[model samples]
Target chain A: MENFTFYNPTKIEFGTNKEQLIGQHLAQFGVKKVLLCYGSERIKQDGLFTTITSQLNEHGIEFIEFGGIVSNPVLSKVREAIKLIKATPVEAILSVGGGSVLDSAKAIAAGAKHEGDVWDLFIGKAQIKSALPIFAMMTLAATGSEMNTTAVVTNQETKEKLFIADESLFPKVSIVNPELMQSVPKDYLVYSAADIIAHSIEGYFTATDQPHLQSRIVEAIINTVIETTEVLLSDSTNYNARAEFAWASTLALNGLTTAGTAGFNFPNHMIEHSLSALFNVPHGAGLSIIIPAWMKWHHSHNTDQFKRFAKQVFAVKTAEEGIVALENWFNKIGTPTRLSQLNITQKDLPLITDNVLNNAKIFGIYHIYTKEVVNTILQDAL
Target chain B: MENFTFYNPTKIEFGTNKEQLIGQHLAQFGVKKVLLCYGSERIKQDGLFTTITSQLNEHGIEFIEFGGIVSNPVLSKVREAIKLIKATPVEAILSVGGGSVLDSAKAIAAGAKHEGDVWDLFIGKAQIKSALPIFAMMTLAATGSEMNTTAVVTNQETKEKLFIADESLFPKVSIVNPELMQSVPKDYLVYSAADIIAHSIEGYFTATDQPHLQSRIVEAIINTVIETTEVLLSDSTNYNARAEFAWASTLALNGLTTAGTAGFNFPNHMIEHSLSALFNVPHGAGLSIIIPAWMKWHHSHNTDQFKRFAKQVFAVKTAEEGIVALENWFNKIGTPTRLSQLNITQKDLPLITDNVLNNAKIFGIYHIYTKEVVNTILQDAL
Candidate 1:
C-alpha cells in the first residue's frame, strides 16, 4: 500500500430508461440553456435525439444543437463548439453519443470559459479553472469518459494528440441507460470490450503494493469485465451483459481502483492515440494491438502483479498462463493483437515511440522506459 | 446486475503522514473556524493533538474543542455540541477519532441548522433536508462513518438506538491515515472487525436478485477482512493490515455494494441495539452475539444466498460448515455467540423484539419480521 488521495464526485445513473431523467438532473445544477453535442448524427438515428429532446421539453430545458464532432475530436471542431457556446450562451452541455462526442463536449465545456486557446490546457501550459457542467446520455461504454476526469483531444494542425486531466471537467451527472447501448453496432461492441480490458490490465499489473481492499476492488472489476465482456461480445442485445460491461468499463478507469498505487503510465493509450491520429482506427483496436506486446516486453518488471492477475482474472495456475489466457481471450473477440494486422510499419515506429515517450511516464515501475525501449515495444507489437 | 446509482464525493487522503494535508484540504472548502470533535483524550496523549493544532495554527485556522462525545453517541451530548456550535458559529466540523466520535459530530452538524429536535430526525418523524459540511480524520474504521451518508445515534431518553440517513451528512473530506490505528486498543480493533463483517453479511444476503457484481464486491471485502483481521488481531501494530481493514469497513455499507440490492434487513443491528440499550455492551460485541443467531433463524429462507455466503466468506464447501466456520471465527476473536453468555435473559427477549420490530425494518426473506419471529430469533440466540 502507498499514500494516496482518492475522490470522485461523478454521479452515475444505471438502468433502462435512465436517459429520461437527464433533463431533471441537469436542472438541479440550474443548467437551463444547453449545447447538444454529438458525433455524425448517430444519436439522431438511435432515437436519443427524440428521447433527449422530449426530456428537455418536458423539463422546459432549452438547447441548441452542434453536430459533426469527428472521430478523433480535433481542436478545430472543439473551437467551433466553443464559438457556438459563446454565441448561443448555453449554460451547460448535453452530449448524447459515444466517447468522441463526450470528449469533444468536455473539451469545449472547459475551453469555452478560458480567455486564450484551449490547446494550452491540453499541453499543461494552463489550468482548466472552470467549465460549464457537462451532462452525458452515454450511448457507448468504451472511452470511459463519463466517470474519469480525463479527456483526450487531437490537435490536427500539429498532429499532437493530447489529454487533459482536471477535476473541473467532471460531468455533473452521467445517465448510462444500458438500453441506449442496444443500438450500438457489433464491431463497436467488440472494440469497446477491448478498450475496457486494456484499462484494467494496465492498472492491474502496474499498481504498486496496493492495499488489500483496493487490490481486491481492481480484481473484482477485472473479474466483472472478463465475465461480462464475453456475454456482451456474444450478444450485443443482452442488456444485463451490456450493463455489466458498461459499469465495469466505467469503474475501470474512474480513480477508485487507482486509490493507493503510483502507476500513471497510460502507454497503451498513448500508443493508441498515434494509431487513432495517424489512421482513424477506433481507440480500442489500437490499444488491443499494443497491450499484449507491451505486456510481453514489460512483464519482467511486474512479475508479482502479473501473477496475481493470472490467479484472479484468467484463473491460470501461473502468471505466464494468465498472460497467454488474456491474449487468447482478446484473439477470440476479433480484436487485433498484432500491429501488422492494423497496418503499422517500421517507418512509423519512431513517431509512435516519440509520442509514447513524450507522454507515458508512470512512476512506480522498476525500469524507466526510454524512447528506445518504447520503439522496441512498438516494434514487437508490429 | 441490477439498476443502481453510485456516487461518493468524500476526498480521502490515506496512509502515514497524510494528515499533514488536512489544513490544505480544509482550506479548499473555505473553513477557517473549526469544531475539533473527538471522544477521549487519547489523541491529546499521543501527539496527534499537537500535530493537528500546529498545522491549523500554521495555516491560521481558528478552532474550538468538543470532546464530550461518548461511544454510541448520546442525543443530549449531541445537543450540547449543537448548543456550543450555535454560540461559537464555527465554519465546519473536523472530527478526529473512530466512528462513534464522527457519528456524534455528524448529528451535531445536522442538528445545528434545524429548528426541531435531532432525535425527531432519527426516528423518521422529521425530514432532514440539509446539513453543514463535516470532515473526519478516521482513526478507527469500524462503522464506516468516514465515507458514508449514514449516522447511527442512540437516544438515551427513549433507550432507543436509531439512525438518520441523508445525503447532507456525507463527510466533505475524510483523512484515513492508517498509521494512526497503531495506538488503537486490541479490544476495540476486534469488535470493529466484527462490525465490518456484520455490514457485509447484512448487505450480501439482503437481496435475492442482487447484481452478481455486488456478490463479488462484498466477497472481496469479506475475503480482505478475513485475512487482515487475523493479522491485526495477532499484531495490532500491523499498519498495512490495519489499513486494509480500514478501507474494507468503509466500503462495506457505503452505498456501493448495496446499490441495487433489495431487502437488506439489518436484523443483527436491530438485535444488537436491544442489547446495547439494555446492558451497555460494546456495540460490535452486541452485534457479534446477535448476527449468527439471526442467521440461523433466517438462512433457511434465503438458502442460496446463504450457501453462496458460506462458500465465499467462510470458505466452507457446505452451507452447514460455513455457518459453523463463522461461529468458530467469532469465538476465535473472543466474542460470544449466545445471548445468555452476554448476560441477557429469556425474559428480555420480548422487550428486545419489541425494540427491533418498532424501530427499523429490513428483511432479506421479503416477509416483514413480526415481533414473534424477532422473539424466536432472540430466544434461539439464548
Candidate 2:
C-alpha cells in the first residue's frame, strides 16, 4: 500500500428510464442550454433522441446538436464540436451515447474553454484549467467514461490515439439506463466485457505494491463482469444482468480500484492505443489481443499477483494457467485473441511498435517499454 | 437490484501526511475561516492540534476552536458548536477527530444555517436543503462519517439516538491519514472494525433484491475489514493494515456497498442506537452486542444470505456457525458481544425495548420490530 487520494464526485443516476431525466439533471446543474453530442443514427432510429429532446424542451432547456461521433472517437469530430460550442451559447455538454460520444463531449467541453487546439491538451503541450460542466446518458457500459475523468480521442491525421485525464473532466451527472443498452449488437457487448476486464487487471498486475483489500475489489469487479457477461450473452434482455455488468464496469475504472496502490501504469492500454490508432481496430478488440501477449511477457515482474489472479479469479494454480484461461475466454466470447485474428500480420509490426513507443513516451513508461521490448511483445501477439 | 440513484460528492484525501494539507484543501473550496471542532484533549496532547493550526495559519486561514465532543455524540454539543459558529464568521466546519467529532461538525454545519432547532431535521419536521460546507481530518477509522452524508446524534433530552441523511451534509473535503489513527487504543480499534462490518452487512442481509455484483462489493468490504482488523489488533502500528482498514471503512458506508439493492432497513443500527442512547454504551459496542442476537432471530427471513455469509466469511456450514464465529471473532478482538459483558442486565431490557420501538417508528421499521419483537432480540443478547 502507498499514499494516494481517492475523490470521485460524479453523481450516477441508474436504473430503468433514467436517461429520459438527463435534461432535468443538467438543469439542476444550472445548464440552461447545451451542446448535445452522440454517435451514429441508432439513437434516433430507436426513438431515444425524441425522448431526450422532448425532456430537454420540457425542462425549458435549449441545445445545439453535434452528431456522427465514431468509435475510437476522432480529434476532428471534437474539433468540429468545439467550433459549434464556441460559436453557440451552450452552457454545458450533454452526451447521449457510449464512450466515444462522452469522450468527444469532454474534449469539446474543455477545448471550448481553451484558446488552442484540443489536441494540445492530449499531447501535453497545454493543461486543462477548466471545462464546461458535462452531463451524460450512457447507452453502453464499457470504458467507464461516464464516471471517470478519462477521455481517449484519436488524432486521425497524426495517426495517434491518446487520452487526457483531469479532475475537471468528470461528468457532473451521468444517467445510466441499462435498458438503452439492450439494442447493442453481440460483438460490441463481448468487446465491452473485455474492455472492463482489461481495466481491472492493468493495475492489478503492474502495481508496485498491491494491498489485500484492493486485490479483493479488483477480483470482485472481474468476477461480476465474467458472471454477468455470460448471462447477458445467453439472454440479452436480462435486465438484472445488464444492470450488474453496467455498474461493475463503471466501478472497474472509477478511481476506487487503484486507491493506495503504488507505481502502476497501463502498459496494455499504451500498446493497444497504437493498434487502434494505426489499424482503426475497435478499442476492446485491440485490448483482447494485447493483454494476453503483455501478460506472457510481463508475468515475471509480479509473479505473486499473477498467481493470485489465477487462483482467485480463474481458480487456477499458476500464472500461466490464468493467462491461458483469459485468452481462451476471449476467444470463446468471439473477440480477437491474436494480432492475426484481427487481420494484422507480422508486416504491420514496425508501425505498431513505433506508435506504441510514442505512447510509452507520452505516458512516461518508455524506460520499461523501449522499442525492443515493444517489438518482443508484438511478436508474442503475432 | 432496483431502480436507484447513487450520488455522493465527498472528496477524500487519503494517505500519509494528508492531514497536514487540510487547510489548503479547504482554501480550494473557498473557505476563509473555519470552525475547528474535535473531541477530547488527545489531539492537543499528541501535538496534532498545533500542526493543524499552523497549517491553517500558513494558508492564511483563520479559525475559531470548539472542542470537547464525546463518543456517541449528543445534541447539546452540536447546539453549543452551532451557537459558536452562528456568532462567529466561520466559512466552514472543520472536524478533527473520530466519527463523533465529524458527526457533530455535520450537525453544526446544518444547524448553523437553519433558524429552528437542528433536531427538526432529524425528526423530519424540516428538510435540509443546504448546509455550510463541512471538512474533516479524521483520527479514527470508524462510522465512515468522513465521506458520507449521514450524522447520528443522541438527543439527550428526548433520549433518542437518530440520524439525518441529506446530500448537503456530505463534507466538501475530508483528509484521512491512517498514521493519525495509530494512537487509537486497541478497544476503540476493534470497535471501529465492528462498526465497519456492521455497516457492510446491514444492506447485505435485508435488501429485497440483492444483485450479484452488489453482493460481491459487500463481501469485499467485509473481508477487508475482517482481514485488517485481525492484523491491526496484533500490530497497531502497521501502516498498511491501518491504511487498508481506513479505506475499507470509508467504502463500507459511503453508498458503494448498497448501490442497486432495494428495500433494505438498518434494523441492527436501529436497535443498537437504543442501547447506546439509553445506556451511553459505545456505538460499536452496542452493535457487537446486538448483531449476533439479531442474526439468531432474523436469519430465517434471509437464510440464503446468512448461509452465504457463513460460507464466504466464516467458512462455516450453517447460519448458526456463522453467528457464533462472528461473535467469537468480536470477542477475540476485545469487543463486548453480550449485554452482560457490558454489565447491563435483564432489568434493563424494558427501557431498551421501549427506546428501540421509538427508533423503529423513527426509521419506519415498526412493522418489523414491535416492542415484543425487540424484547426477544435483547433477550437473545443476554
Candidate 3:
C-alpha cells in the first residue's frame, strides 16, 4: 500500500427527512446566515425550498437565496453569487440542489474569500487558503460533491471545465435524504449510475499500487452501484435501493476508494469534462461514451487489474468480456455508450481530442494522455 | 437503511515512518505540550521512544512521559494519568502505542477535564462533553482505537470493563505506520486478526435494519482481514500485507461498516469485556472464544443474516458451517476458540454469565441478553 493521508471531516446526515434538520446542523456550526444556492426552480416546486426555509426560521437562521445554477456549473453564475456574498456576506453557503449547485457553491465560497479571480485557483495559479463553510442538502447523488473538497466548474467564455481541491473546500455538513432523489429524471438516474461507476473504476484500473483491500472497497462500491441502479430503474421509489445508491455514489469519490492507491488518474473525468464544456452533454452520459472506449484501449496497460475487475465485478472470464458486460449493462439501463448515440461522429473527434488534451495538460497528465492517445480513445468511441 | 448521522472527524496519517511526523501533526493542532502515553518499556528498548522524543524536540514541542499501561487497560492507570495531567496540564494526550494505550489516553483526556470520578463517564451516571485533544501513533492494529470516538477501559475495583463514546474523545490525529506493527508477537497478531473480524461481524449479523450495501462493505473488510491475516502469518515482514491488515482493522470499527444500519449491538464485545474485566483475558482472545459460541446460540434469531454471512465470508452453504469455519480458522491461527482452551470449565459458566448479564444491563440489552441467554452461550463455549 502507498502512503496516504485520509482526512474527510464532512458530517453526513443520511436518511429520510435529513434535509429538515439543515437549519439545526448549520446552527451547531454557529452559522446564522447562509447563501442558499440551487440549480433550478424544481426544489421550490417540490416544496423542498419551503421546508428548508421553515426550518431556518425555526432555528432563527437567515438566508439569501441565489438560485439558477446549472449542470456543468458555470463560472459566471459562481462569480455572480460571490459578488452577492461579498456585498451581503453570509456565514456559509447552503447548497440545496444536486452536485452542480454544490460545486458552484464551493467555487463561490472560495471566490468570496479570494482576492484574485476564482478561476486562478482552478488553473493552479492561486491556492485556496480559506473559504466560507459549506453545507449541502443533496437532491442528487452523482459527483460525490457533497462530501468531498473538489469542485468542478466551467468557464463559459473559455469553455474550460476545471476543478479546485483544497482542505478548505470540504463541506462542514451534507444532508443526503435519498427520498429527495426519487424525483430525478430517468435519464439523469442512469447517467448518475454511469458517473458513479466511472468514479469507482478510474483509480481501480489505473492505480500503480493497487492494494487488495482498496481494490475490494472499489469493487464493493461498484457492485452496490450496479445492483442499486438496476433496482432503481425498475422501482425508483425503492427507498433502500435509493439510499444504497446515494451512499455508494458518495463513497465512490469521497477519498475512501482511492486511499493507499498510488499513481492513479481520473482519465474518464478528464475526458468527460471536455464533453461537458464543449458539447454540453451531461457529464455521466459523456462518461458512458468514453469509459468502454478508454477501457478497450487501456486494458493492455493494466491487464491484471482488468482481469481482476472482470472476475470480481462482472463474474466474467476475461478483460474483454468484462468490458462487454459493462457496456451491455449501460445499454440495458438506456445510457448512451457510443459517440453516435451522443450525436458526435468521427468528424468531431479532433475538437473533442483537442479539448481533452487541454484538460490533460492542466491536470498534469498530458505526458501520458497526449493528442495521439486522446484521438485514439475518441476514435474507439466513434 | 436507517436514519443516521455519520460524523468521524479524526485525521489519519497512514504509511511508512508516519510516526516521524507526529510532532508536526501535533503542532498543526497548536499543541505545545503533550502527555505522551504508552504501554510498556519495549518501545523504549526498540528506539521508538528516542525517535518520537527527537521529533518533539525538533518541532520545539514539550512532553511528559506516562508509560506502563497494560492490555485490558485499567481505570486506575487512566486515573493516575488524569491526576498527573490535572497537576501539570498538557495541551494534548499523545498515545504512542496500540489500542490499549490509546483507549487509556482517551479516558485520561476526558478524565482530566472532569471533576467527578472518571467511572461516572463509563457508566450512565455522566457524559463526556469535552476533552483535551488526543493524538495517537499506533504500533498495533486491534480494537480500532486509532480512529474512533469510543474508548474501552476496565475498572479494576468493580471488575467492570466499560467504554465511553463521545465526539469529543475522537483522536485529533492518528498515525498508522504498519511497519511499526510488523514486530508484533505472532500470538498477538492472531488475536488482533480475530478482534478485527469480530468487529466486522458484530454489526453485520446483529443489525435488524441491515442495508445490503453496508453488508457488502462489512464483507469486504472481513475478506481483507482474513486474506491479510493468512499472508501475515506466513510472512510477518510483508509490508503490503501488514498495511492492508492495519487499514482493515481501522475500517472495521471506524463507523464505516455500521453506518446506515440500525438495531445493532456489539454482543461479542459485550461478552468479551466481561472476560477481560473478570479474568484479565486479552480482549481478542476472549472474543475468539466467545464469537463462535455466541453465533451458535444466536444464529437462529437472525438466520438470514447468518446465511448471508455464511456465503459471503466463509463460502459455506449453512450458518452452522460458517460458524465452524470461523472457529476452525481461529484455531488454525493459534487463537483459542473455546472456553476449555482458555482454561475455563463448564463449572465457571455462572460467574462469566453473571458478569456478562451485568454488562448487558448497563448496555441496555438486558431484555434480550437475559441471564439464561448468557449462561447458554457460555455453556456452548465450554
Best by DockQ: 3
Highest lDDT: give the candidate number. 3
- The DockQ values of the predictions, listed in order, are 0.71, 0.83, 0.91
By DockQ, is 2 or 3 better? Answer: 3
Residue pairs clashing, model 1: B265-B362
Tens digits of per-residue lDDT for model 3, A1-382: 9999999999999999888788888899998998999988988888999999999999989999999898999999998998888889999999988899999999999999999889999888999989999999999999999889999999989889999998988999999999999999999999999999999999999999999888889999999999999999899899999999999999999999998999999999999999999989999999999999999999999999999999999999899999999999999999999989888888888888888889998878999998888888998887
lDDT scores for all predictions?
A: 0.81, 0.91, 0.92
lDDT of 3 by residue, B1-382 (tens): 9989999899999999888888888888888999999999999999999999999999889999999999999999998998897899899999989999999999999998889989999987988889999999999999898889999999989889999999998998999999999899999999999999999999898888988888888898899989999999999999999999999999999999989999999899999998899889888999999999999999999898898888988989898999999999999989998878778897777888888999998887999998888888888887
Candidate 3 ranges with C-alpha deviation above 4 Å? none
Query: What range of 10 consecutive residues in model 3 chain B has the weakest lDDT sum?
Result: B339-348
Q: Which of the CAPRI classes, incorrect, acceptable, medium or high, describes model 2?
A: high
The local distance difference test score of model 3 is 0.92
* Residue pairs with backbone overlap in model 2: none
lDDT of 2 by residue, A76-195 (tens): 989988887787769999998999999999999899989999999998899999999999999999999999999999999999999998999999999999999998899999999999
At residue A351, candidate 3 shows an lDDT of: 84
Cα TM-score of candidate 1 = 0.95
**Best to worst by DockQ, what's the order?**
3, 2, 1
Which pairs clash inside model 3? Answer: none
Q: Give the winner by DockQ: 1 or 2.
A: 2
